[model samples]
Target: MHPLRSATAAPSRRALACALSLALFPFVAAATDGMSDARTLDRVVVIGTPTQPLTFVTDTKLPRQPVPASDGADYLKTIPGFTALRNGGTNGDPVLRGMFGSRLNLLSNDGSMPGACPARMDNPLSYVAPETYDTLVVVKGPQTVLWGPGASAGTVRFQRETPRFDAPGLRVQGSLLGGSFVRNDQLLDATAGNATGYARLTANRSESGDYRDGHGDRVPTAWKKWNTDLALGWTPDADTLVEVSAGIGDGQARYAGRGMDGAQFKRESLGLRFEKAFHGALRKVQASLYRNDADHVMDNYTLRDPNPMGPMPMPMASNVDRTTDGGRIAAEWGWGDVVLTTGIDAQRSRHRTRNAMGRDAYKTVAWSPDATLRNTGVFAEGTWTLDAGRRWVAGLRSDRARATDQRATRSAMGMGGMAMPNPTLGLTRSETLPAGFVRFEHDIAGSGFGWYAGVGHTARMPDYWELISPNMGPMGTVNAFAGVRPEKTTQLDIGGQYRGKRMDAWVSAYAGRIDDFILFRYPTGGMMGATSMASNVDARIHGAEAGVDLRLAADWSVGGSLAWAWGANTTAGTPLPQMTPLEGRLTAGWDNGHWSAGALLRVVARQDRVAVGQGNVVGRDLGPSAGFATLALNAGYRLSERLQLAAGMDNLFDRAYAEHLNLAGSADFGYPAMPVRINEPGRNLWLKLNFTL
Candidate 1:
């Protein structure tokens, strides 16, 4: 894992002096038992690697569940401060800090992979599987520029590592899952390698049937998908690694809430990366390139029967496709008490669309021209150790991004209407953004105390798709996304950590204000009934997270974590849309020589404050929602040095509840008393077997 440079540029010398002194002030202020020996060591975990950015320290690698993840976002929800927008049973969109779409930089193996559908049915994450990757990283908040720009909420990355062997070796891993509601999944991950190079392949398939609510009522959510990837690597020395990889995936899904369904999601990806460490001068140098393409199709006839209340009330179909490609290169140098890293990155994408009232009309409407988006950036970060117990980190970055609406003409047709072309709305725009940050850390070693404080800022351009496509009407008229401004944010982060053999604790907090925060508001002024359009608005956000681990005894352990966030629009004088609510998790476990068992309890606090209309990325705001809690149990046993077995149950009590940030309730899911909430699964059980050599 690697640390991402902060976005804030620099701190005042006076402020820096104060930050420097206070970093170590706590150690000198107190004298107590068991404190002096514990506070001296720096134990920060490396964050994201260049290829896969957003990562969490806590992981579910050891947890129990069926069905492999299909994308990076799906895997992220296992961590805190994360949620999803459920369309049906699967392929739910990921949300962070109550933000979705372009707000989070979603990257895989060092590249940007945007979905192809104008409606985003094949989001980049739809092609990822966490179990197939060796590592996952997440960074919350607009923390840095190592992974590209416009990551105001943060960055989420999933990556696979190249394998090397001194001798010929082969590895194979597979899993089978089954549970209630006919949920089933299959996964195969295998690799073969020798001293000079290696090859690997991975594939996954999953499907689930409709589920029932607590009241034994049937819900329409259901889904299925498949993905496969292949890779080859070359290694000339122990310190050098190079790899090339390619992958393809496709799937279909049924949605109970929308008029259309995901009929096709085709994905293609290519990537190359190399790393080398210099023995004496600089620490390490790494470079990488990646390209990803998605071709998606949505139709009402493919996934299910047409609904009487749907837009057309008859068999209607429309298709939208878009593709994004991106790459980044970076190097890190370490000398004496200092480490510096520098990098460059770029990305480009385009989109096109066509629609018809019926299947036969598809060929009658020509495809719309593609919309183009491109960006390039440079960044550098350095860390210096002022003394054995004090450290400072500084970083800076700049980017140039441009977007073009390539449609030769736009058409203003009503929903379920014939294609009519309109030529008055088309344009291009460009912007430059810069960001930086500085932080200081101190350890009261031997005192069981340590603390750090940092300030950062980020400037983000509008996402190409968000700025050009989402606002367009089904009839392709009225240009809802014609003019939009970039967004900028400045924030302060501070935290402390405490450790003991029997107890460990940590707390972190952040406060920030955003300028021209890009937002979507329902515009009813247009001739089109109601359409969402992007606009720049001022907003503020702040939050804190805290956790503690305690050893009840030599064989028993207990831990819990809590987080809360508050957001609001100063201009609108209302709460920001889609903000997550207070949540908490608690776990109790017992581990011995060969076996381990554990149980987890999760609780979500109800939310009453809402933007009135601002809701999920694709759904509406239903106001506030009631909170619920669920429990899970897990156990693992080591069969031998080379083998292990594990099993677990989710939603142990079979509680039927929904999250606050949900998609619109569909015929499949009973309409909610409030807004945007879907029924959760009942009790689910799964088991796994592992082998290593």
Candidate 2:
């Protein structure tokens, strides 16, 4: 086996491991066979909903179950075809089919929460806590237009549902967890309602210490966070409902790849929504508006313990803060067998910065506007039922966006001999983009088999942060992304699903071509040091994913999922960098009346083809990475109707491994000495206690 793909067990021990895994199969089978056929077919377990084939739903209205969700992006990786650009123990930036940032629309309660850091320290999801919301929904690829525009990769929404009651009622659910490496978490959700109105509150706190890798080596990535939200609703009748909601969140983290750490993240959000159901021609009408604000603070001081041997040596500091204010109004109306949806959206964002070398020195530098940007757009989509078993959907959208970069002068440093305060001058850009899509679906077997095909197009404008961020390396240069052109993409997707009493399965495939794809490149010839720049290049990508669940007996279940992806830049006739390798996951579990146990095995194939340079819009590409496989085991027990417990160990075999999309550790972590690409945790132990009342 290649060094990276070596089997965790030696040839001599392989037999022992196999025997152990098979020994428990009989017990699981016996328990599963005890369940009634009716109950088995009626149960529904989902992480997403049916807006699209790739979409999954998480309903917070039900008691929350334990899933290993350390961060917003980490939580998303549970979906097939989804991966993360691992930064540290957490905050791994989410990527879908090799796309990141605005390419994927992320929202909370229908509000925009864009980040400010040039390096994206305050990633849009970093401030979000999944346990604090009522729902988590994700639509993969440009498969739907219910959210917003420029969502070629997909859309993610964290929402809170309104409560209704004909009489008075109250509900409360909470969880507490303590585990290895000083990990601890607390979450609470409560709601109350009367015949005329309702209210809800949610809060959560999480923290963990530096963790040891598979080889028992320490990795200095740790953090803590907290957030809370409140909602009030008015429901005078069964057909009409209105709600007002607000939320706040803040946190700090230690990063192993960047110079500065996340010291403070402050967020505020407000929203209003109205929904009504008509008795006659129209079935329902729904509309909502939301506003979000994010203020971030980053520096070398206070956040993390200072290191004399680190890059700064001295306590240098700089802070960039931004405010994003936006709202969307949409309505969905149904007539007979057809549905029509339309919406408009607008947002304004501004940034300001301050810098100083000494600890408190920067406090005196007057903060001034660094960048300003705005966007306005409108969209419409219609779904028509052509026949009893067939339907068609079509959509169109247009957006006008403007960006202004204001700076006295570029740093004395130059990128690739291109001096600052460029002879070409600062940049101002205004772009108009149009997008559209069409899809067809049909029910093959009325009993629960269906297939669908779709074609989508999107014209995306470069975001403001990417346009003026620093190069972030020894180079001291800046990445002038302002001159970059808008990117356009055309894609075709096809998928099918089958549901039955003993088995359930789904499969999907996609092929796409992109024009002027924005590619980030690192230049060895930096005017000062090493600098990375963003540019446009042509590219094409294709991938497929399939999953199946089988009930071996009434009490036993087995399932597996597989995904494969490939991409190349036609401009250079080379493989695309950071493309996820072919991977597969197998799971086996058993559930009796009061207890459940399961185990998982994940396999990854090596990637030898690479472009040698191109990477994500904000990260660097490490060419052709090796791959491996790992195993995990988990079990849960119900103590009573309102109480439960769960425990699990990931990397059960304690195998040493690293991912293909991993970032290098920093000086504080003894980086190069421990440069095995930051191996995953050897063996992790966690236990959760859940209560519902």
In candidate 2, how many Å is residue 476 off? 20
Whole-structure CA lDDT of model 2: 0.70
Write one digit per residue (lDDT tens) for candidate 1, span 208-326.
55666665665665566788999988888888888999998877776655556777777888888889888775778888887777767777666566656544567767666666677
- Once superposed on the true structure, which residue ranges of model 1 sit more than 4 Å away at CA? 1-55, 58-61, 64-70, 360-366, 409-426, 470-480, 523-530, 667-676
Please, what is the TM-score per model?
0.86, 0.88
lDDT of 2 at 218: 65
Worst 10 residues of 1 by lDDT: 1-10
Query: Ten residues in a row with the worst lDDT in model 2?
Result: 37-46
Model 2 alpha-carbon drift over 4 Å, by segment: 1-52, 60-67, 280-283, 303-310, 412-419, 422-427, 470-481, 524-530, 673-676
Compared with the true structure, what per-residue lDDT tens digits does model 2 show for residues 462-540?
8764566544311223445445778898989899988899998888899999898877665422111235566777989
RMSD of each: 13.0, 7.7
